[model samples]
Target: MTRSTDRWGVTGTVTATASATRAAAPDSATVAVTALGEAASAARARKRARNRAATVRTAIEATVEVGIETVDHRVTNSAVTFEPETDAAFRAVEEFHVRCEPDAVATVVVEATDGGGGVDHVQFALTDTARADLQAEAMTAAVDRARRKADRLAAADGLAVGAARSITTQPARPGNEPVDDAWESDPSVHPAPISVTERVEVEYELTAAETDMTVANDSGKG
Candidate 1:
């Protein structure tokens, strides 16, 4: 009959976080239109104001060259409201949300809305491709850090860290949230850095160290 020694192992659990950052540029802006008009008939006044607002929206769209520049735009709000004044007037207020790349184009979009509507919000953000790449980089760094910690811990206990048995990861979170960056007219100038952080918990297998193996052999001989 063959005798087998009981297997021994230790799980090293470690949590590590890593962050990656890139300069954020303006990726989107909001154009708000308030077209006001007064007519003898309420319906006519509302129609006229709404039509004017629609025209402004069309002009803004043309400036961006939607398909060519590959921009994402949508009408966020459109409503007609009346105010009590010397003469009843209807104001059609509409907001257009625009997002695109090569941030410099944002200036062109704002100019297009000029004389017709006002740009309400200009914001900075990371592109989808950039976000994905950074996330991968951060995750890799976190895993490496976890492995280093595991190795150190195992060394302390006269053990060798082996292959990872299991790994648990947390969703990546933005360290800094996107915000209005209208203060800087030039989107490329002194852009703020956006950081993404990722956390991971890893469990690694442990193997017997050389010293432990020597002691086991000595006991067997006795």
Candidate 2:
């Protein structure tokens, strides 16, 4: 006859999957500023475009924030009007990005756009410290959810929970939805919540049932 000890293996393992989410407030804001100029002469158009860019840079320097940084300031287009009317006319457009303390986003936007610039889009994001903290919480919540589900499933199968045999985790990313655009114009407008979600699939071993049943049956035979 085959012995129960020889048959012991990974049989009757239960797998559980679940996901958890948590919201965190964003700590930084990014804004895009663009400028366009048209002139009767190519030289005049170039000078106006340069002046517009300079105006934006100076405005940025005057603004107060925890800290402000500019990046990717570029000229998108600069050409003379030839197809429509070659009357020595030219047009130019330049764009730049600004990152600053969350609270200062609206003021910086207003000041930068005062020089005939337009806002392209605004993004609110988490700080390093906040991201780490939220990620930890989300993972714990996901694992706990998996454990609870496993317990119920194992009990229904007339088995008890045991050590985890294997586990898989899903990394976190930026929230799926964008923050409110209106917050760009009015800093007082609270941003929509930023969320982090995590998913985990865990396989847990279930205690052997035949071993205990055999002992009971032997006692009855005695």
Candidate 3:
């Protein structure tokens, strides 16, 4: 028998790849309200936008006690421009983000978009705790799937599987990084389920021949 060992134990090596997917309702929501205005003067345009934003903020504070905190929200984008050569009007823009519970999202969005409101967008997302928990569960499921696969393949070849020699994950895609989830909020809308997937590749070493490969063979039948 030929034997070789480089990274994942001896030459009797088997590799298993699998992906686990999990779906859950979002736990929280974030609403983005953008206030924009145009006026003859820069200061006047800015004031108009701020006034409109304040009205929306007051509406939010009434619905939810959290209110739009100034420190939490920031001016993500802003600019001023002249209307034309003859016209000296300036346009102003400001955006504020509001974080609130999933249940309260509908109420807040309605208030923001009501009566020509300044709501640019409303988004739904999973809470930090929910995200972390789901990640752990998905990872466990992927590993279990890989191990089971390895066992069945080894049994078919009249061999027994040993400890994993190495384990690694495929490089994530360019835009696969975790990004803040957002959506347009509607009263009758239900938050979409959050789906998380975990992919893993494991290499296991062949220990010895299986005397009775009944379990591995039977499990694969179903």
Top model number, lDDT: 3
Model 1, 27-145: lDDT tens digits are 43333334444465556665665666566556656666432221222221122423344244433333445454444445544644563655554545666777667667777788888
How accurate locally, in lDDT, is each candidate? 0.53, 0.68, 0.69
Candidate 2 lDDT tens digits, 1-222: 011223443245788887788787787777777765568665666677667877876777677553434343332223422364323356656667777767877777778778667778777888778877877898789889999998888766656667888889865445533233335456567676677788888888776456666776688794
What pairs collide in candidate 2? Answer: none
- Per-residue lDDT over 144-216 for candidate 3, one digit per residue giving the tens place of the 0 to 100 score: 8999999898777666778888888764344443444556545557766777777788898876565444555
TM-score of each: 0.63, 0.74, 0.75
Candidate with the greatest TM-score versus the true structure = 3
- Candidates 2 and 3 compared: the better one by TM-score is 3
Predictions ranked by TM-score, top down?
Answer: 3, 2, 1
- Better by TM-score, candidate 3 or 1: 3
lDDT of 1 at 55: 68
